[model samples]
Target: MQQFIVTPEVRFLHVVTEPSLRLAVLEHISAGEQHSDNHAPFFVLETPTWDGEGEWSGRAEELRADYEELRAVLAQDVRGVSLPAIWKAPSGARELTRFCLELSEMLRRLSVSPFDGAVLVLAPVEVREPERWVSELKTLLALEELRKARLMVVEVDGSHSEALAVALAQEALRVDARPDEGQLREDMATMLAGMAAAPAGVTGAQVVGAAGPRGVSPPAKKTQARLSGEQRESLARELKMAPALFDPSFQQALRLKVFAAAHAMREGKSTEAIKGQREARDLCLDAGLNREAVILELVLGGYVLQAKQAPLALEVFCDARKRAEAHELAELAVQAQLSAASTLLMLQRFESAALAYAEAGKLGLVASQPLLAIEGYRMCGQVLARAGNVAEATAAWRKALEVTRSATADERTASSAPEVARQLAALCRKHGLKAQAESLEAQAVALEEPPLRQTQGA
Candidate 1:
């Protein structure tokens, strides 16, 4: 394999059948990059500006421009280096003129600071025109300068049928990497994500006539913080998450084991606690105690979290949520749902987390749990805001405030109402919603007023 310093054969493909493989494939690519000095020998583009389950905004022509962000990323090698931007493609060019010019210009940039090829992963939310995008990419890859550049399109959850169709169109080169939970925890905990590389070997340029725009000065380098599972899952614990919404059908012996597990947790014997709860959970299921089993599973999730195994905790919470719903354990469903969603947020899968939060909020509403409903909606706003959906975020926060206000007579609900109103008010002020902000602020004060005094004023 080391016959040459670099492998020249480049390819484009998808690994959509298993979402877990997305990161596995990324790891494989990173392993290859370990041999190169370039900081960003690869880039992943999954987020989209347009709104579709995939890419569909009716402006297909603007698709190429949509990825202009890539140019700055790849153009990193030319930054502050002596290179002629002499091969600039005409801004007005169209069709073959555009493609040819772009290819030619990219080749020129490659000469002074030649990148040893790149892996470009286009994990779009969805790809509406797989063939069209592929065809466009082929035109770019046709040039030898880009010989090592490859495209890998992926959808992490395998939720899209287009992924399968896209794979069939090509002779499938299967990526066989599988998920290892413990390994994923360790890997993510210490992972150092790569980005744009600074150029080397270029000194100063000899101007033929004049200098071109000082070729894109590199952006300040920032490092991504390592994600650790060891962080406390304090968010869920504080929520006073309920056990399964069911009458306890515990055998005397099984209840003893459950108590022992709780005792173990208090003693900091997380592993023992987790094992005990799992046993209790299984026993409950075997004894036709589906709701009781779910309760035990929920207990087990906390044990898993305490042991600093958040990935496994998330899985347990998700599994419990599904089962809780099936058993119509509304209260427990909201608990498990929010836990699973928050874990996703910690994992930095923003879109999935946002959707999960929305589901949890809606479920909380259905369950008539005002505090849980407010929390779910509030966090959904937070996740949406983090994902750059300000409008949606505002709406979510608004919904949370509404829920809080409607249930203010309840002690727990009233206690949290002012804070919820202030949160929405802050968001409103940030986005210049002055009237809304003022209204929310007034409501926040009114919420804090004693019920008798408030009624007299009204």
Candidate 2:
């Protein structure tokens, strides 16, 4: 097999039907011929066979064992902390996105660790959605921490090879497996020369601005004349009264009333907004629209929170949460619990806030919303820290990290656990828990990549 020197900047490589190529790459990385840092971790995601079972299963197990052996060898022989290899089957759609997201998050965490080394990702041959996979890979590449991560895609039976090549043309290079010894040597030497010639500080730029991953464009600025306070009040009154005339049968009218109340609040009419929200909530309840009633209650809770009535907000949010749970509205229940937790925090009920946050996180996890769960745990840590319970705070933060790490295969946490660790570390340092602070700081570093420092030597 031909061997090429692996550079830190090499992000993508495509091998054509060469299973041993992964071993060769690992060997080169372990040798540390092109970099000074220790060999990093390896995470392998193999695509499941078409039937989802059969001979490929045993083959996959064998490959996984081989990867484990390779990891052991690197750890022992090369004196590197080669973390365990992660093997995953090719999950379609949501699963694929989750896989990519998890890998990206892992790479990000690895980048900040003491090792500060590269990661190798071995992809499956028959990627279900090549274009989408490539797109996600591009997104991962755009992440700062994952810049040193490399992807190796092995093409089997020429499956989507051409399409994959085109999609990843800018980021990946084709690797020739059957090259002659002379050709292989030349390839390695050329790669080394290219790495040496490459600029150290090459940066990427965003070509287009977007509001979210779905490519939704930002709303255009409104050019209409702004309504005066009196006009707004008049509109609010009209909306509130309009719902009553139709015997409150139109949910849209009630919704409009809620919107008017929001507008009034934004216009600084807090008293009027509170009154409007109460009236709306009562109307929704009277109409037997429990879901709508819960929403209105949440709005009222927000108004109370804005008015600095933390106690009232807590009550309202708690009621909303109960109503949402009774209605089997998981999303609304999670939101209400989070709102109640915030109110508790505002009121300096630290222990209660922590409990509420934990409850919210549990609800989020049960609802399969990993981001919400992560936020909840993160808040729990903050509240504990504020209450002068460093140990408990650290525990909560660790729980958050665990949740992030063990998030469902289809869930995305957006790296919230690392943020929690970072914040907790800062809090620990502030509180003079030197030993704890150091430990947390190291965990934070392992969980997140700090901004790169400019060293004179480099």
Candidate 3:
């Protein structure tokens, strides 16, 4: 005999009515779903309280607890939620029309997912407009088809509307923005009183989101590193992956991975650092980032690897070179050549190193990197001198000296000029060009003058 087990479908839901506050709530939920390990069913109903007063009815307690727990976990204090707005009101706040389209879209999404619970909270700052929001909430409550789903209504105290100003705040899911508890209590009192005096059949809890919890308070604030708007937008941009190909949580995981890698690099953990760097590139690519962005990441990875494994660094540089060439990324190609040159020099391959330096110089010149171009010449001189090619070395030094002299008037002297001159002088003496050697020395001395001294001399 076999026993049959039934898994009751669980759906979590939240509705926010405040305009300013809903952005934070939406952000939190989006971030959580994109990052959280839990796979439980949760649906959020987000909107501005159309006017100010709205009747709400639903299975309330369940909604409140689920939201409070979520807020507590995300350490909600750091990131302010964001919402869309089409225009600003006379008071400089967002007008309600912008939220209407978003609200309609959200409702459509919720209807597609069966057994998904939802929460709706309304925060209307315009005290005089409560009746309009009340009407909107009433419309939401009339949908009996979602009878099993939970709902909640949060009314902000009109006095502190500045603090409690939107649907997410109306929902009170997380505590990023809040006022005194007494202020909230007063708002709740006004809401209850207004509901009691409403017309028959269109009255309390009947016109708002399905009633769930009432007079609930938000969690206390906590200390955590919060993300700025740029970070949130960047994270959101990363989260636009195909629903089937990669889990939404990949965005959050990638963020954590980036942080870990940066920390590892700071701690001098080369292996872990390299691992993190690779992970960021993989994640970014998976998220459909452009080739330029990915190459920038690869460049950073190469730098980290070079600090630990010179051989691996060269391999990374080669990979970067191929990718940059294919994508026409001239700057990245130059960076790759520079890295390759350094790696070859590290391996004591003077000829190969000189060729790498030459490649770098060509790329640098193409990319308008004057300083790098000068250094490239100096490196060629060193490698040639080291290879016992005195004539060629002296010529390379002379070219570098020419560039240094030309740049002296531009205030962009290459720091390596003096060293290049010394090397060139040595090469000149070896090749029996002592005058040329002394001429290079004098040029180096004149260019080495402090910027202030240079200005005075000029």
Top model by lDDT, which number? 2
lDDT of 2: 0.59
Q: How many residue pairs clash (N, CA or C atoms closer than 3 angstroms) in each of the candidate models, in the order given?
A: 2, 0, 48
Considering every candidate listed, which one attains the maximal TM-score? 1
TM-score per candidate: 0.42, 0.41, 0.41
List runs of model 2 lying over 4 Å from the truth. Answer: 1-249, 406-415, 424-458
CA lDDT of each candidate? 0.57, 0.59, 0.49
Error of 3 at 412 (Å): 3.4
Determine which window of 10 residues in candidate 3 has minimal summed lDDT.
1-10
Q: So what's the TM-score on candidate 3? A: 0.41
TM-score of 1: 0.42
Model 2 Cα shift for residue 243 (angstroms) = 16
Q: Which tens-of-lDDT digit does each residue in 1-458 have in candidate 2?
A: 12222444455666654544645644443343224333454434443333222213222332334344444554564434454455453443233344444445445444433434444444553555555545555665676745666655555434344455566556566754543656655544443333333332211211111112233322434873444556645765777543233331244445446755776676668888898899999887776667778988998999988987788888899999989989798988999999999888888877888999999889988987777888898899878877778888888777777776666533432456645765665566566666785465455434433222111110
| lDDT score, candidate 3, position 239 | 80
